[model samples]
Target chain A: MQILFINNDGGGFADQIKIPDGTTVSDLFAQRMPGRNASHYLIRVNRQPVASDAVLQPGDRVSFTPTRIEGA
Target chain B: MRSASRALLRLAGKIHSRVESLQPTCSDLLLPDADWSRCRAAGRRLEKAERRGWRLAAVRLRRELRQAMEQLRLEMHRIEDRLTASERPPRIASLREILDDLRFLPDSFDEVRWDLRQEMLSVTTEPIVLEGFPLGRFTISLDWTRIGFTRPYHVLAREPNPAASDEAVTHPHVLNGKLCEGRGAVSLRAALESGRLVDFFTIVDRILHTYHRGSPHSPLSEWGGVCCPGCGDRLSEDDLTPCERCESVLCLGCLSGCPACRGLFCASCLEPCAECRVRTCRSCLSSGAGCGSADGSECFDGVEPCEGGRAQNRDSEADTHALLPV
Candidate 1:
């Protein structure tokens, strides 16, 4: 299955990635960013916030935004 | 006519002329010493003439004096009207009129532009310098008609040269590079009406400064640098999660997430399932029991029940199964 992944780290990079069936948001986060703390970022599925245990459907638009971006 | 009678008539005419001349100085009538000595002298002369067999001349003098006094009273009224008119403040019927009356922009703003069609005013502010942050220029857009009615104006900032360490744009009152202050339009209107453009800018500066000083690791970060609505705890620039349904800023303790849909909810909004110990929304429960139960019988929580005999509970213990960051 394929899903749209958007990372708001730099340039708001967005792309489609292939994932196995029954994969949760936390699993995807671990695969993408292994060492970073999951609590540091806000994870959303299809523009709606979801828990780390939320099951991702095929074609789901997943976004990972930092809880606190550098701001003045 | 007798000599005394003729003299009384002449004195009466002089008193009338003197009173007429003092019409312009009606305001001076209220003073301690005014130029009414000639009128007083004429009255005395008329009284003596009447006692000395000039009764008809004295009567004529009294009539003339009364006429002059009536004219002077009218003149005082006219002067009062003019003075009151000049003292009244200029009437402003609309926001455009107020802006038009402004002679110059405040020093904090670089430029101001108005769009009559949209009833919007855009102000570009001078570069704002904050500690440990790049110089930023703020652009504010105010909807003149709705400024103090619906919501406060929108604010956006642009940094010329962003810091290399963390390039992601951020603001204390900003979410996704957009200002999200929970202020009413009344405050903005008050600032504009009072001509306190500097005060408005000061408020923006304070929001940015507070956000810059906040630590992202704390639970206060999600509050957008505002106090929590529930416990009144001041929130910093950390990851305070807002309620998913209503978007109310919340602290970690105040936020509750549904287990079935995995959506975040506020303390007052969270509902738990009766059959399974999962927090579910009313809509989710109504459509179908998302708890993957086969029978779908008697699965109601007491917090918020669906159309059927379902009951829901807003139990915080359900947080153990919630999938939120906290």
Candidate 2:
């Protein structure tokens, strides 16, 4: 599955990657988030950001955002 | 109800929900399918060790999750603090005459960042000028990690402006925090050169004093006047003593004789005259017999003030006495 991570916030970073079978959103987010700060990150599966309860499948794009996003 | 308060309550609720959901349940860390099947085989392999005890492994697992949660709390607090801190004003905005001197702050930090990068490139780039004063040349480096974690919204660092750093390194008098012996200018210039770690009281003092002079809101009216130490009016070098005292502008108003010490003193250095019940200049008073400290404390026990001048008891005494209203 192709996963796309997009962080639109200023001072943000993003990446796109292909995931293997049975990769949960929580697992993907844990891998993506920085050490010790992963739990604080808001994980979004696909285009819709969701809470940790959301699950992920093959071809899912996951984004991790530090809760506060700045505009302008 | 007020719109802002309602919005704030909504924000608080969302934050509370997010924080509560962060705690992991038993199945939260569990892997599915292949990972679980492989884990079963691994567990079987570890069965011999498990016989000895799975207690250590369970303890390690629990400890790891607990540590992660602890880290999460700290990160949440830092984010909260940074967000709230922005709502408060930048302390520098309150300095007197500071904005007037600089006009407008750079609209964006882009130019500053670019300049800092370019200066760092130059093998011989002189220190960048700050607040019209010069500083010694210094190196610049981007602290992306610090910017990432501590203050995500803004680029923050202790990097000095080129001119100010050049002046500091070149001039033997200045340091990272202390001011040089000039007009002192409300200590704003010093605080500005210092990266974000501004001294709060120094800025507050300037703010209060600035307000005292005239406008409570204006930052430009906070100057202590440069007056003569001789006549008790604004000091003029042509026919006055323009000596600076304790980094503040010494005006002619405070100049007088110390009754006990009889030394020619500026108002800052003067004490109440022993003979006449009025403030006397330190330069006109003797140090011991009963002269007080610059702050008017009668230190009878022993410690004398450093740097005293001769006490003048001439006909100037009558003229000095005439200045203070009886």
Candidate 3:
């Protein structure tokens, strides 16, 4: 499955990424952010907030925004 | 017989003529002297009636005015009483008395300064350990003048957690990084009146414990989590929305998104479209069809212009440069 991911970091970037079916939000976060804490970032799907355990579907628009942007 | 009837009819005619001659003629009644006398009698009666009516009206008006004045006087007296009551200063302990009470504090507090200008007593306590967390040097300010029967003596921490970033942690009831304990003025007054430094220290200790524990009781906690600025409801993190422009964290109720650009905004920062009633940000308003008119008559269509929208537009224009990059 493919999803559109919007990352509001460093000039803001949006890209489509392929993920395995039934991938949870936490799995995606761990894959993208590596060792960073999940609580430090706000994750949203389709412009709406979603839980870490929420399963992702194809074509879902997800956004990852840091809770506090540095130097903001 | 016929001659007798004729004589009778002649006599009746003479009597009628005599009666008519006794009555005054229309021309005679028209004379000024006669008319004036009649008019004066009627005028007196009318004048009497008018005077009586005016007197009655005046009496009623005076009564109403007197009642109003009495009410106003009573209101003024009530307000004056309240003013006197509130303006009466609370009984406060003198500087010497406060310093004497400071003897109760432990020897850990090394330095003390009485700021006469600010009416505050500043104290520096040595580094303390609470729950395995080493609290660096802490400065406490106790305001004497502000402490009394009703007013709460404020206890503030000047340097809270010297080693940690100020933004890294949030302390409940702490304003501007100062620890403010107690529910309200009454509780605080009681604590201050106790004149025990241990009581004050306990509050500081609790603040530090709560900070280290990362579970300070927030007023918004009762509402399930942080309160939404828009609806005043408690919401969890999952239900929150961050404003793209102001970065304000708000709940769905207090947040609106532009349908065109999908940019989230706080309720106060978003403007409703004059046509569809959908909320839109200023950027969307300029670029999209948010400002379109329904019938090509006016940009606002037939809907009344929202005061918030107008004020927001004016404010946005004033800060356009700062807001544009966001």
Tell me which residue pairs clash in candidate 3.
none
Provide the TM-score, chain A, model 3. 0.90
Tens-digit lDDT track for model 3 on B1-326?
Answer: 98644543443333223222332111111223433444455455546656778554454344334434433333333334333333332223233323333543434256755544565555665554443444455566665544332323333444443222233223333445445332221222223443333334334443344331122223223223556777776555446767887878888767766655667788767776765576677776765445433222333434543443455555556676677765
Rank by lDDT, descending?
1, 3, 2
Q: What is the DockQ of each candidate?
A: 0.02, 0.04, 0.01
Of 1 and 3, the candidate ranking higher by TM-score = 3
The TM-score between candidate 3 and the true structure equals 0.28
lDDT of 2: 0.34
TM-score of each: 0.27, 0.24, 0.28
Q: What is the lDDT of residue A46 in candidate 3?
A: 60
Worst 10 residues of 1 chain B by lDDT: B214-223
TM-score of chain A of 1: 0.91
Angstrom error of the Cα, residue A35, model 3: value is 46
Show model 3 residue runs off by greater than 4 Å.
A1-72, B1-106, B116-119, B125-138, B149-152, B155-170, B176-180, B183-188, B211-326
How well docked is model 1, in DockQ terms? 0.02
Error of 1 at B290 (Å): 36
Best by TM-score: 3
For model 1, the local distance difference test gives 0.49
